[model samples]
Target: MNDDTVTATPAAPAAEPESMPAPEQPAATGPGTPDPADPATPGSRRLLRAGAATAAAALVGVAIGIGIIKTQYDDPAPATAAAPSTAPTPTASATPYGAKSNGSHFGSLRDLLLPVPAGYRPGPDDGVYGNDTELNGEQLSAELDAELQQIPKDKRDKLRSYWEGLHVKATGVRTYLSTGDDLVIGLKLRQFNQQEVQRINEYTAVFTGDTGLFRIGPSIPGHPEAHCYLMPAPPSAPIDYLECSAAEGDLLVIMNAEGVAPLPKDKIVALFTLQLDRLARPGASA
Candidate 1:
């Protein structure tokens, strides 16, 4: 489950125009002309010749001028009348599950897609992981696990099953789990899910130091509605894990760790809450 191992679906390419030949021009005419039926007098013939020559010359001059104009201002080929630039049709931003919003502002996958959990409180660290920010994998996991342990064991197992189904694997132990309405927010939950899997694999490589196949489990208590993964760090370093979910009106997020330097419990709770707030905002889905 290394990050590099995760691949995204490719997008389509734009279309191109085909080449074609140019049109032929018409023959030029003179001012004066002689009847061919009559073997015209020399004078008349001369006049006719002169007229034809003049007409040809004039036509050439006009063609040259037109070429110049085309080169300077006009498009060479019949210009494609520009299609009216219709404004992009706006999509409805609000959904029954939540509101639409951007995920970029929030650091973690959970924050980017869902609203903060209700009755949530930070343990101690306010700015560290609590306020819309990132907590190291180890710290986040430890805090999350401690919270999830508070839930009934059966509930925890149900949550774990959900995550296991997704085959989520990281390099650490999970510490916390929480849920919110993400589908309604119009978040690119599918893309987020893919990225989460990739991130778990990446962290696994970082923790193990040596490259190897890592298997992630599914749902856990705190993230009952979402999927989870684990990747234990090397003995010398802290483990790292991540959990994410995108269900009808719910989003579940989880973090884990099992070593020194675990993320503060308060910050972990706060981070989840902030994510939910963003998801609940209007226009977030767009």
Candidate 2:
């Protein structure tokens, strides 16, 4: 946003009044007596006419003086001295209206995805066929259609209608493996309408909150909205699994971890934190 400065202009000074000629005075006359030669005399009437002219001139002068005084009182105040010239300090531009922390985003959704970290190579692409890790709208729609195949037709139709209302826009995915223990980390980001993205957290809580099949996982510190769930493996099973999801802006961030019975809970939380941080702070390096 830019700052606006309002400046006031000084009013011009009122013009000075022009000088007026003084009227001639009438000659002195005795009470009840008139001089024939005097213009103000009753016979000639000149003295009376001269007296009237003098009085009119005086009245005009008085009126002119009053007008000048009123004009001075109504004039605007004088302008202040100009400010000193100096280099302007730069200011950061305001964030766009539709772009906010954990509410909305305006840039490429794929750009907001967390970058592949050190010691981990790019995981298998989740897009249709051998497509890139980033999925376009059409590809995502096809994937959804495939997933809906297992459900009954009526239920699938209703779910599809609900999904359509979400207006999913894009998706990004990355999978990587640790150098040791063969631990695999899969990350998926889905961008949709903000309202639908928010509902993901609520849905995850209801479905994964207290199911006997999965144990409560570690909470993402500093991110109360994020939730994690761990599937308890059978005694003879060789691997354990964990899933975490968070609603960040218009993106639903998901992480799936599979490894030996004892998954690195700390590392999982740390990675999830990094991904969430990336979404929250668009300027930060992925």
Candidate 3:
């Protein structure tokens, strides 16, 4: 049984062992080529180290280039930066009111002159009518309170004297205008001959420039030919004043304002001159 079992076992196929993967072969090389698997090859080692160093250098160069670009972009922009005008800007006048400049009569002396600024409405006229001597003092005084006259009494009398000899017929136009506050514009126009014109040129008056509630009048600009004075603000009286006297041919013009005019000196003068221009035009008597 043992001999038969041995024969059968021999007859049984030889036992097969587990298969193993083959070793990776080193690549074939030319006579001068270094073996990549050989760690002892100095030339191969140097080539690998050099390649790694070049790659590192390339990465460093790329980083430095990016840094340079970032620096240029991050630079800050340049950092020095002109005052803003305070004059009254009067608009053009309304049709009928503004039409005085074209040599048209405005019915009465009150209608002829500009009462307030261009945009405002004219107020009531409170004045009188007469020839020069009669119109000069009593009529004007009656119209205004005697207390309103800040000039010394004699000076006021002296002013009356200027009209004593002048031959002229005049109408006084007085009215108030609503600015931010209210104001009065007074105009006394004496229509006359060459003799009266000569009288106006010959007249002269004094201003003491006194300090008190009274401020001496300053000469209005653009009136080298006219005599003008700016008066003080009347206490609780609700007004300051300016007076201008000028005589053109056949006309003696007295322009007065009872308020601190809301205008620069030059602009006020320009406006006054414009009024005069209108009155002096032919067929447009003040």
RMSD vs true structure, all candidates: 32.9, 42.9, 51.1
Q: Candidate 1 lDDT, tens digit per residue, 73-175? A: 2223222112112321222453234433532222334334433334321111111122223333344335435544644565335433333333222211111
> In model 2, what lDDT does residue 46 have?
15
Best by TM-score: 2
Model 2 agreement with the true structure over 111-164: per-residue lDDT tens digits: 566665676544432212111255666776675576556445764464455556
> What is the lDDT of every predicted structure here?
0.26, 0.48, 0.33
Q: Which stretches of candidate 2 lie over 4 Å from their true place?
A: 1-102, 125-132, 143-151, 281-286
lDDT of 1: 0.26
Angstrom error at residue 21, model 3: 99
Which 10 consecutive residues of model 2 have the lowest summed lDDT? 1-10
Question: For model 2, what is the alpha-carbon lDDT of residue 97?
Answer: 26
As for lDDT, the candidate ahead, 2 or 3, is: 2
lDDT (tens digit, per residue) of candidate 3 on 1-286: 0000000011001131111111111112223223435432111111111111111111111111111112222322211000001222233454343233432333334445444457334433321121111243344334323322533455334333333433334343433343433343445444444454534333322211221312334554444446654433224322234556665555546654543333234544655677676555455433
The best-first sequence of candidates by lDDT reads 2, 3, 1
